[model samples]
Target: MIDIKMLIELFVFAGDYNWIGKERAIKMAESTIQYSNPVIPGFHPDPSVCRVGSDFYLVTSSFEYFPGVPIFHSRDLVHWKQIGHCLTRQSQLDLEGCRSSMGIYAPTIRFHNGRFYMITTNVKMFRNFYVWAENPEGPWSDPIWPDWPSVDPSLFFDEDGRVYITGTGGFFGDEPKGIYQAEIDLESGKLLSERRLIWQGTGGKSAEGPHLYRVNGKYFLMIAEGGTEYGHMATIARSDSPYGPFESNPDNPILTHRSTGSSIQATGHADLVQLEDGSWWAVFLGIRPVSVPFSGRHHHLGRETFLAPVTWTEDGWPVIGDGGKIAEKMDASTLPLAVDESAVSETDDFNSNRLQLEWNFLRNPQDEDWSLEERPGYLTLHGSALTLNDIGSPAFVGRRQQHFRCSVSTLMSFDPLHEGEEAGLTVYMNERFHYEIALTCGVEGRRQVIFRRRIGSLWKMELVEDFEGSDIILGLDAEPFQYSFFYSLPNGERKAFGSGECSLVSTEVAGGFTGVFFGLYATGNGKSAKTPASFDWFQYIKS
Candidate 1:
């Protein structure tokens, strides 16, 4: 509790670390960003960017996390604040049974005329849809389901006001082969043309995430290939007409790390944006791997959003980064390092009427099951019937475990009347893989703190200790491979538990497309609870 404010205090007083007074603490908080490359960090992958006026907006895929598709706004294109979510309403998306990496796929955001349009595929719903808002910050329209069912859908608006939706579709035997496009009646979400394959993408596997654009009167088609892993790549094609007969760039993949010994890998699924000064940029997804490569080099942080410079060749083909590679350090003149410190805060005060955009539920949550205003300050999560491992939506809300070496702690209070009722912190990967430390009813009507891990088919309580109180500050400090759990009383010393391997809840082990999430949960073990478990505050500090 000595420094519970966490790294946020660093940014708050970073400018004046030699603080003379408390008032200066508030004033100097807007210190310039001091982050390395991959401008936006942790699990924010499949980036699609667009610029309207001087402001640049980016959206990333949020698989299985309700409040799907996070919309980030950046003035300098380097620093970003999540303005809102494109799919905020239940009518907009339903991820009730979505497994990890199986909800929203790649989304492309565009601003045309007066409205901002965001289109993507809801894999769980098996539909490609788009939502529009006059203001990018939202009150966005509900899901507009286009008739076509495909992943990685992109919307293009032509100069003559015609519209098209391009995506990874059409099957070659069992595998979905090539990129497809179809003219669409934007107003009614009706297909105006038959869905047709446009480009197969330089003979790479899984040609997908097609974004159509017009540069200098020629239509440019950008796509992702090689299946979003170490072999991932960014490829392009160009055509004279809106719908093509497009020819692949001879220098096919415009960007990729591929066989390079570099740590950043899986570079593809990109979106392009042009600045007012005519500077070109590409926002794509990539990952920084740890030391070990096989079972050990797990990317617990998931695919992150990266910014790279794009230089168009004399013949009009684009070259990403310096030479078809993702640079670890981005140049200053290009992005300028200016960031709003609020975009990536280490702490959430939960002082607003609504939950912050950073908080996400396991699935489409029952609206009344959780609240911020219900308790004025603390987040009150009423216990739900589902458990953490259940396919049904649990009363669990969490944020992406953004860093491998970070500490997340929460102040929680819950009184369990039955033996199964519990509430505490959880490191959730998916329904089949997760770990939790909870305060629950134990033997002899005594309250106890417990540790439960559900990995693969095994589900068991690992440890239990009797507790005399309801309120406990639960903490977990994570490293790349290991994480230690701890609990502290309101006035007592912090108690540390045995450390666990980070791989237990990883993509390599859990077999999913998402990273880990540090979140708060309340559950009655498939039954309702008498009262709600309240989380006073949560802290996320990069270690």
Candidate 2:
């Protein structure tokens, strides 16, 4: 068998003829980004972006995860720096009984007046609201508006200083749903007019994630339709007015993956930005399910962020997504530099602002419950009732694992588990697909290293050792979508156990529309047990 590291090296660098060409082009592009480049990867859904001078700020939905909107900054709309999370306050959301699939939906980020605003839906609570900040890093204000029956809310400001919010709520009778826009008073947070239903959708059904943009005297509304399933798509409509008797783009369903092959399912929820050069590009979410006919298990590499160039017609409407079908490979070389060298850092020294981009909570974050400075050297995670189901739980932090061939390793030591205490690292994909290495106290007052995995209907378990140790390395090696867990002792011997060679199942295969994530967690099972866990650090390498 070929060595995994060698195979990756060969795949990435084997061909030499285009190295200089690739490097020269790539270098030119990196020059534009002041911070990091290719800022994020894989399943950063419902992206919202706003440009303020030379800097660009972006946000994405947290859905059953806390830290509701993740805020990122960029200079060239390329390399993004994760600045902070927008809704860190508790009063902003309630995730009780929030299933793994519920919570915040598509969010819209906008800059208006003197502040920055983000609007989104809390699906479980059935409300649409907005959060704003004077500065991007934010002491963002709490939800100023709440409990409206809408999801995917986008805010629009017209020329005369009128403010409007656009979103998708429940269906209008049986016709799926249409974009709804209502006049809003920015200062008092009041809706001045009833919601006006506009842009029924493309010829297909299920319209959502509406973004309103004004270009060359016309108001354009871009949205995704055809459900977020196999036929996911992005379409456009335009009107002389923001409220719209809008006209659909003749080239409706502007972007898609269906034509290439059903296997490359491209569902688009897009945001557009015009460059300093006046060139246009759209940052949207797309899917490329790995499984052929859709299985009940794994869909490893779907639901990822994709960028495409856009050309405006003489009529001023924008076209996107390979124009019609996603390209197998495009001359990304032609694109001018958007970021300065892909400067993203996957390694964490634990000394930055909170956790690196790697860490994510299960649901909305409990800000007071966590601190990077309290422990100084270690991350302190307080326990919350948010087991695995509540998207608003307080005891979970995770990061995206993008490369198929990579290794994730972390160091953890706990306060010692009593009866109900559990803390560990995990490779999680929904509730159904997860593998964990935990430190739990045994019945005899000793601790044990327990490994567990959910294999179909049963949870398979194994014991590496009977709690004889404290400091240890929990590592996961992933090749393609399959993962294997290992324990590297302080002395450096690797032991494989629990959920051996398990395939990661995502919404694309597991029947949802989300992506895969690996996380660290601590749980208290009703019994009185002190939370005994301090994580040293987490490391990921593309082997």
Candidate 3:
């Protein structure tokens, strides 16, 4: 039943892809040429893309996760490989107390003078900073905090050698709001010009996520508005000069699904680039409703990165999606087919020196609390004072729950000596929204597997059964609105415990800027534990 040669080959490719393994090889056998929506899947949002010769690099918002801003390398735009993160070192960022959707906002990636530049806002922390690296997978330079007076920051190097910054908001009370711009000295990160108001959008609320580009001798300003919800839209304006009293496109709101009732909603915040073939494309963010739609079109996976072709009229303005709609299917491309097996890595063996790129903590983590080499082939997480519901970062590491129909399982060896010690698998949206099936010590040294659900201020926990709490396999299967938990006892008896409404951990219910993350966690309830919890393996498969 097993093909040894194929398995070995798959491992080779997996190592090449960093986090992808057997599942990728199996899926490659069944792979066909189909350009689908959410080209870069999962909870990756606020995509910014740029081209460097035949190579293409794209980065997306990580919000509260770290290392922040996943940087992907793509040769054919359709297939992408996450090479590394822009914020790999602690000196590059600080998200220590960042709550859900409050840390790293949106990032814009561009290339100039043989260097890769990434500029973004760190929300409540670092206001605005830019970093540069010769290679996409860095050793990047430390952040240079620029005095850009906005939230969604972008950099435009003019033909006359002036570098301009464009963004939204009034950073200071007296500064003008809407989309603002200023020229900055790149070396000193100092503003050189007075902040100027560019466009207020086409009268939409919250005109943000702006990108400026020079195409065909015209300066173009593209922005997103309507609050990043169902009413979100993309609009464009252009002028002869970068700092403009620019003219708006009569057919404004160029890219939006509002009022169309399309499955892909809130389609806006796009960045454009021209490929080697001279073909234009855009990478933006969109929310996909679950199979069973709700009154609010509640999405559980959060906003995901989507790819669509962009066409310029003979007049120079950009039009995205097919006939202004992003289609699920498109004609196959002449470029070679590439599949990202790592997007749905079937098994993470925890045998490597570093965690996979997909794994991230709630915020900036205390380096001493987690390790990969302590147990030879396991992830050892020391218990922390913070619990899942606490405001600070807990001893947690998770990957995005990208697909609605999928299963997440882990084998953990944790023996708690006190009622306060606990470790297990969790489906978490934020501090106020999550579900966990954990092994915790009870009265008289008895350890019990418990199911707990936290929604806003209410906390409900149920005892599933008793366990010795060593080398136990815990699992959660999600489908539509339901998520079921299961466990394989040390003696090999399989038991299904219970289920919860998937919406309990959804963005709509949680009221945050993120999606669900299936994570492994160890906690001390309120005190630090005496020993560490070891997880042997983790698996996430999309059905």
Candidate 4:
């Protein structure tokens, strides 16, 4: 038997300085704090963070998912809590018919004049807009369309109360592609000056994600380059004025993992923030490849948010991470560790009236498709005509597969009345790449469990087993290399159904900007089913 109390004491002694003394706490604060990289894991990418006093708030891109631009709040930069989404209303984010990884792109969150502003591009709409809220956890205002026609728009408020909009300048055919800047009226969203090409990045393709900061009385213009792939990088240029002949830093490409054998790759699109203690830190995006045998690189978790310390050289240039490189684990001087207990829950019994912050729909979901109050303590999904193979919205609710090794289980009560109706679990990347373990009605209306996979144009029903009950537990175990699916009855022995290669739904094979989502779904192939599926509970636990 283990000494449980002794183990608890040892764990507290390791982290809680109050258990020791104030003197030791001071020494511990001075010492480096070791933390894991990709701080906000899973499909979260294109991170932008801002500090309001001791509290830090961050936002990330949400592509075609409804309620776009998920926002997070943190006390210490290491631990984060999802507060709410910026684009909650359909008027703010209309993702209808939007393709995967093509809706919202590269949102920048900033606090100015007692208001929090979030600016980004809706690539599908070919427009740049912003929203403002009095509180970070918001009832954010509707989109205020800016006159600028570009992507990755960032707002810079100068000391003279002048507002400047800096962004990529490639949407229009006549303008030369690079970083563009112009003065703007913050209230009216009107351009006050002509947009000017600031600095073409150091001969890197796709010089975008522009951010302008006034540091040390100098305007520092930083942008992401190299197309946000293996060659992605963050570069900086400085000048006395916001727009002009800016001098590129002697050490350009301030942060990147290109051409490196490190596990973290595609690092760029970073935002800088100065802590209350006067320390500088950067929040960026990077991807971790699965440690499996594959022809080329494969990452199923998508680009995730990462943190690194930023130190300035004597020459006033910024040094990021370690020599423009970062690792999975980072040791740095940081704020005291603070964990938010309400950040997320591993299990959901569908006890609440509304869905939790972790849950997201494929796109703009139809109100008639899903319900929590219909069958109290259960999530009821009325199967729609749309299937997973369609680009349109379907009856599905999913959360990001945050951990490489984890287990997801759901108790579903569904009896398909028609042959095409299916209700069960899925490991979904997009319409073209996904794997499913579903309960359906087979020939002569015999209840069965089927395992299906869709890789590009290939669709195959790999496994099938006879099942008796309408209520069954469907589960998926995710490993570094594969996902094993299983099923069981209530209080009954579990049975292994089938498995699928993890790389099949990876970004390398699927070729998308999004990652895999462990989801519960219901569909009728091409026609709406008369039956509905009800999930009693859903659980996700990391191993």
Candidate 5:
């Protein structure tokens, strides 16, 4: 349950800390810390973190899900609270072609010049954009610029106060590509001059998601390459100039899963931050092999975010992962846990003013079209045409599949006797791998449940029809690589709808290199696809 009382109390403390001297406030926040040295699962991939005095704000990519960019605040960088969503308006995102795995990519968060800025890449449309706000709790500016061959963009304001942008090229036809840089005008949301490709990637044509940092007297450029798959890695280079002929580290790929070969396949995309005590820590994305010992079957968890401490060697290069795989268990000598343990919330009542921070939209979201408070006590979803595949329609909403054993249920009703109306739950990824249990309203009034997994552009689909489609309960049961569907009939009896063995593959499996997501969607197919449908409530229960 959410601790409303504690949250209210924290507000009072936050205000008091501002009035206190910097040293005094830092001491006060540090003194109350109970949990120190948070271990594994500290955070997820594509992490964006910023420190404001003693408080820190962190966010992660949501990709095609609305309530995009989940925000969290923490005093010790271990315990966190979901504050709000950064991209709440529809104009800020375009999701038409955004497969479940596409949409938002790696994001970089920075605080500068009395404002907070977030820069991210959208791979589906291949554009790099930025959002900013005077306050972190924001009515943030909509994204600026729409199309570019940019992926994984980071912003750096030099000592002279000139802002520069760096990113990896999106096109595959590479001409010895490396990290590139250009002067950028924040006000106009435009690149002022031509971009310079700084360094050819250390490896083959896989370099992307570059983040630039200036520390000591040298400029460090960090990047992820070898694709986001078994060969994923983190490498770095350094130069005296921001636009540089950066020299790759003698021990390049300072962090990687490559040493474990195809077995522990890990992809590393990292963001670096300095702790309040001046220690350097890096938060990056990585994944372990599903079936250990290098089996090619049934992978469990997908790519996830991780934190590794960094130490600067006498030679000025950065060392990560402590000379082994990211240490899963670390001694809690630095930051202790305030509570014994904490986990991300996995349940929803549909009664809050907003969807839980875990909920996201298919692409960018349109606020006027959907409401969690419309029912006042349940989630209300409005219909949109953007089907799962339409980049123009906004017909999708989703949450991450954080557990292998979990059940998703939804309460839904369609406009009675209206033809071509369908609404229900879905485990979606791209146009291909997805399953849905739908309530269809028409003269026939059909309550049909279906399952579909993509093999390419084509879908393998199975449908079972019997129950009347008027306001029914639908459920999807998933365990590992298998799935079973269930629904309650109007007669108040339960029945097995259908079942299928599936490979939980997404755009990543299809070679697009993106994460998978499962959520709820309402569609009119393609014709009259705008017909409105609503979901009373959607819930995820971990059994």
Candidate 6:
């Protein structure tokens, strides 16, 4: 059998002279190349990727979620696996009283000298810092606070062994808004040079998310412009030196979907990577918005990470996607496709001593409110005084709703003592905008099942029914436009209870950076409950 490596080597050696060799090689490798967009889907925004040899590592922004900065590992760049998170310990991230979208923002991960560094800003704390680790799935070091005062921090390790930090400027007192850069001491987090305004974008609003790269003996400064909305775009500038009198690309806005009727919108905040095959690809954040009648476009899944191929022009500028645009499906010749089949599981039985990497809390959780070993084979959540309506962290644990059409169900056993005590499934967007189908004790301590919808300040109990059993199965079926709620008994038939409009919890209506989460929650409204809620199993299947 002829080796595939030898065939590729022969094709390269034949160069432009042998068209037959090139065609045969391309045909032989075509099956392992094609992939869809949003390589890492659902609420994973502000993506940053770094390549180490044949392996690729990626990290995304996790706003107001405990265990911030979800890290992923991939070999083909099209398929990704959640290895672990960069900030796992409380000392690394503190989201205690943070608002829905005001915790971690735009983390840039880079590997230098065999060590991995993730730098980002905690908007709630108003600080810029970075954590380091030897391994991507890690026990990362405590954050080393830098003197810089900006969001979306990125580090560039130069060939001269010097390090430069770049970020969105003008957040400091009286500084003009633009992309800013400064040389820094990596070990001590001290500034080695004065902060300088590098390049004001090409007359776009809110020029931010800066990253610097040296390619073909010239420094390229790339940034996102146009306010991270429908008009969002990625632009680039080139200069002879790092601190530059730079020239913008003649065809600016390297990537965008603005002013178009495409399904994907808000495309920007991109990071570039050069693969081992010397091909260039970019990872950017874009939202897939579903058009609703009388409501324009609404995206409930938040900004997702998208991949696009990059090609260079004769004049030394990079053109992204197809003439500054990308679709839901993309065709590219990538590394041999490798997928981690066990990365995302469809069902979690709650039998392990610890929760999986996909599970995340709204904020820093109180240890006494949740337990995995208390019931041996179930997840027990003690009803906390902090309800989901409050801005505090309640007894809740959730994972991102990754698909537009999916089914999520959980088997819960709870015995409520007070009228306000409730425990069950929640399709949560934020405190003010969510849908909950819970098992609670109604007035006179009567067992009941209630479906409530909270839209801003208006709260309504849409469905209520008396229940007689201690164990119930709660389920949520999500479509592009609506979410249907259901409940059932063990090994029994399912009954539809109510439904909620998906547009109500979308970023267009709710006004947040996060997506919807299907969670299990236990709350006592205003006081602590005497009973605990136990969840036997949870299943999420993408339909």
Model 5, range 120-231, lDDT digits (tens) per residue?
8766777789899877778888887723467778888788888888887636675446677888988876777787889767874478878888889799998887877667
Clashing pairs in 3: none
Q: What does candidate 6's lDDT look like per residue over 387-472, in tens digits?
A: 88999889999999989999999999999978889999998899999999999998999999999999999999999999998899
In what order do the candidates fall by lDDT, top score first?
6, 4, 3, 1, 2, 5
In angstroms, give how far residue 5 of model 1 lies from its true place: 30
Expressed as tens digits, the lDDT of each residue in 1-543 for candidate 1 is 012244347645653565444456543332322335677788898999989888889999998898989999887777778888999888888887777678898899999999999999888867889999999889899878888867899999999888999988764366447888899998899999988878888888888999999999999999999988889999999999977899889997899999888878889888999998898989999987775546556676788998888998889999998788866765544443443544466777777788888899987998778999888888999888888878878888899877778999988878787777889999888888888888987666788898888889998888889988778989899998888899999778999965677877766678867888888998888788766899988999987
What is the per-residue lDDT of model 4 for residues 1-543, given as tens digits with 9 covering 90 to 100?
123334445545755755666456545544434678888999999999999998999999999998799999987788888999999998998888999889999999999989999999998887899999999889999999988988999999999999999999875677888988999998889999998899889989999998899899999998999987889999999999999689999998899999999999999999999999998899999999866653777899889999998999899998789978988878744554565343467899999999999899998999999999999999999989999989989999999999999999999999887888889999999999999999998888888999999999999999988888899999999998899999999899999999999999998899979999999999988899889999999999988
Model 1 misplaced stretches (Cα beyond 4 Å): 1-35, 171-176, 336-339
Q: Roughly what TM-score does model 3 have, to 2 decimal places?
A: 0.91
TM-score (all chains, Cα) for each model: 0.90, 0.84, 0.91, 0.95, 0.79, 0.95
- Global lDDT of model 4: 0.90
Evaluated with lDDT, which candidate comes out highest? Answer: 6
* Clash count of each predicted structure: 0, 23, 0, 0, 25, 0
lDDT of each: 0.83, 0.69, 0.84, 0.90, 0.65, 0.91
Residues 1-543 of candidate 2 have per-residue lDDT tens digits of 123334334434533455545455445443332322123565567777887776778887676666667788876555566788888766887766677667888888888877999888887877878888999898888887743457788888888888888888555355346788888887767888887788779767778889998888989999988877667788999999998899998878788765555444655788888766777777777655554334432455436555667887786778774565554343343343353433446567576656765467765565654667776777766555444422345476888766667888888777565665767777776766667787766666677788877644566666546756677778888876467778766678888855554344666434454566777777664433466466778788887
lDDT of 3 by residue, 1-543 (tens): 123345446665775786666566545533434577787777888999998878889999988888989999987677788889999877887887776788888999989898999999998574999999999999789999986757989999898889899889865777655898899898889999988898888889889999999888989999998888888888999999898888998878778998887788889989998877777888899998764454555788989888888887777778897756786665434333444433536899999999988899888888778999999799999889999898787999999888879988888999788877889999899998899998888778788888888889998886557776477888999997899998886569768877888877777778978888999999988899876899999999898
Cα lDDT, model 3, residue 482: 92
Q: Judged by lDDT against the true structure, how good is candidate 3?
A: 0.84
State the weakest 10-residue window (summed lDDT) of model 4.
1-10
